[model samples]
Target: MDRRVYGAEPSERDPGPKPGRAYVELVGGPLDGMLLDVTGWPPQEVVDGAVLMSEHGAFGPGGRSGYEPAEAVAGAGGVGRFVWRGDVP
Candidate 1:
């Protein structure tokens, strides 16, 4: 049987980039160091941005972390970056 690992982790620990899977690195803000899986999304959707909810965010209950697509990094295994805009109430 083959052993495999799943879910988000620091880039340094990753074996390599996964083909056919798209990811966005959540930079800064409360949800920093997190990877958002955006697989199967078209270019436009990626640019549109995302608002993810976090129970542990600064605002506590009903808090949302907003992110906008930023420059793509090749060294990050082609993983795109999403800069934190701000937290929404």
Candidate 2:
């Protein structure tokens, strides 16, 4: 599978897998928190969906506890959740 990393720094670019498959990973933060897999979807979509879910209290106190919006996308493998810290901006 292919891999990529996104953040404030320059995002990594790599040749992806075959047309149908997607790569996924869990990004870890402090206190064992995680950022869900968002391999195939665009960053904007992930943020937008997360915001909508958050506003509606979709996942209760824990955001996207099981199946995250990104994971629900067509090419996604499965659901995953992450804990966010600090200001989103």
Candidate 3:
């Protein structure tokens, strides 16, 4: 795997992957271009999707980003994709 940090500050923001941690790519929506850590995620949570919070969002911050699992995309390493559902205030 390439495993290169893409955007923001890895240590302070994305934090990509650590020794035992894993992450999924967030596609579209306010939290687009972000990586979500799913290292110890429950099997059901990965399947059912997740609602992530963003301090900096489309509406200027402090909103929830809804995402659902989608088919894996190339370069995403079969880690799956999180397609945007919507944002909640």
Candidate 4:
């Protein structure tokens, strides 16, 4: 096995518009492919936040305005004008 030295990615060192935080879109059930931009600092905060929101009915009935929670499915990759809290361009 060849061991690769880890430091910074090649593109990162180039300083050409460094990428922002690593965020994952919430796909599948009750998410409806919403881009829930989360901070990577706390690690599992993304999933935890999702579950929390779900529990708090954020992804349930009346959680999202206009959009119905019943439409949310897993891995759908569905796109819309406005997701949860962010506006899509």
Candidate 5:
């Protein structure tokens, strides 16, 4: 087996302009999947924050917005925005 080394430093790449809302969806689901509604911030920030926050129980019971990490992750799988209108409900 080959071992890979990962860096612990931040990149110098620009994130570009921020957006108004951050929409995400699950890539795959078993049968019925819940959709995640993340607004009030940029997409990148929302995605990054969601991943980090979930790890630290930010989405646990009685969280900041009453969201569970497992539920959120399960709904949106990984995390990404929608492409067309009327996609979110």
Candidate 6:
């Protein structure tokens, strides 16, 4: 498996393996206490997604989203929810 982690502009990171489903809550940022519904994605991806959300956020291309799974969730055959939390820098 390709374990060369990168985030926030091609920088290397090591969040280890994070399999299955869980929620990654953001802390001390604009999006604090926001639960990211991560399904079958590694923990690094979740954190990176949250970070990108916090950094760029809304109506823009978020670069370098790490560790995305093959299957697509959110607005599929089942119900899905979307939440946004962030502050203008």
The candidate scoring highest on lDDT is: 1
- Write candidate 2's Cα lDDT for 1-89 as tens digits: 33332221234344223344433333232212323335677655554443212212334443332222434344444434433332121
Candidate 3 lDDT over residue span 1-89, tens digit each: 33433244746653455655456778888777666767677676777778877666655566777898886433333467789988787
Candidate number that wins on TM-score, 3 or 4: 3
Regions of model 5 farther than 4 Å from truth:
1-22, 28-32, 47-49, 52-89
Give stretches of model 4 more than 4 Å off: 1-19, 47-49, 52-89
Error of 6 at 85 (Å): 15
lDDT of 5 by residue, 1-89 (tens): 21111111125242222244233532222101223445445534443433211211324532222222332332333444322111111
TM-score quality measure for candidate 6: 0.30
lDDT on C-alpha atoms for all candidate structures: 0.68, 0.35, 0.67, 0.33, 0.30, 0.36
Model 3: per-residue Cα lDDT at residue 82: 87
What does the lDDT read for residue 40 in candidate 5?
49
**TM per model?**
0.67, 0.22, 0.67, 0.30, 0.24, 0.30
After superposition, the stretches of candidate 3 with alpha carbons farther than 4 Å from their true spots are: 1-14, 56-59, 72-78
Name the lDDT value of residue 4 in candidate 3: 35
What would the per-residue lDDT of candidate 4 be over residues 13-48, giving only the tens digit for each residue? 342222453334443444444444333325333323
Candidate closer to the true structure by TM-score (higher is better), 2 or 6 = 6
In model 4, which residue pairs have backbone atoms overlapping below 3 Å?
Answer: 28-73, 28-74, 28-75, 29-73
Q: For residue 89, what is the lDDT in candidate 6?
A: 29
| Selected candidate, larger TM-score, 1 vs 4 | 1
Worst 10 residues of 4 by lDDT: 1-10
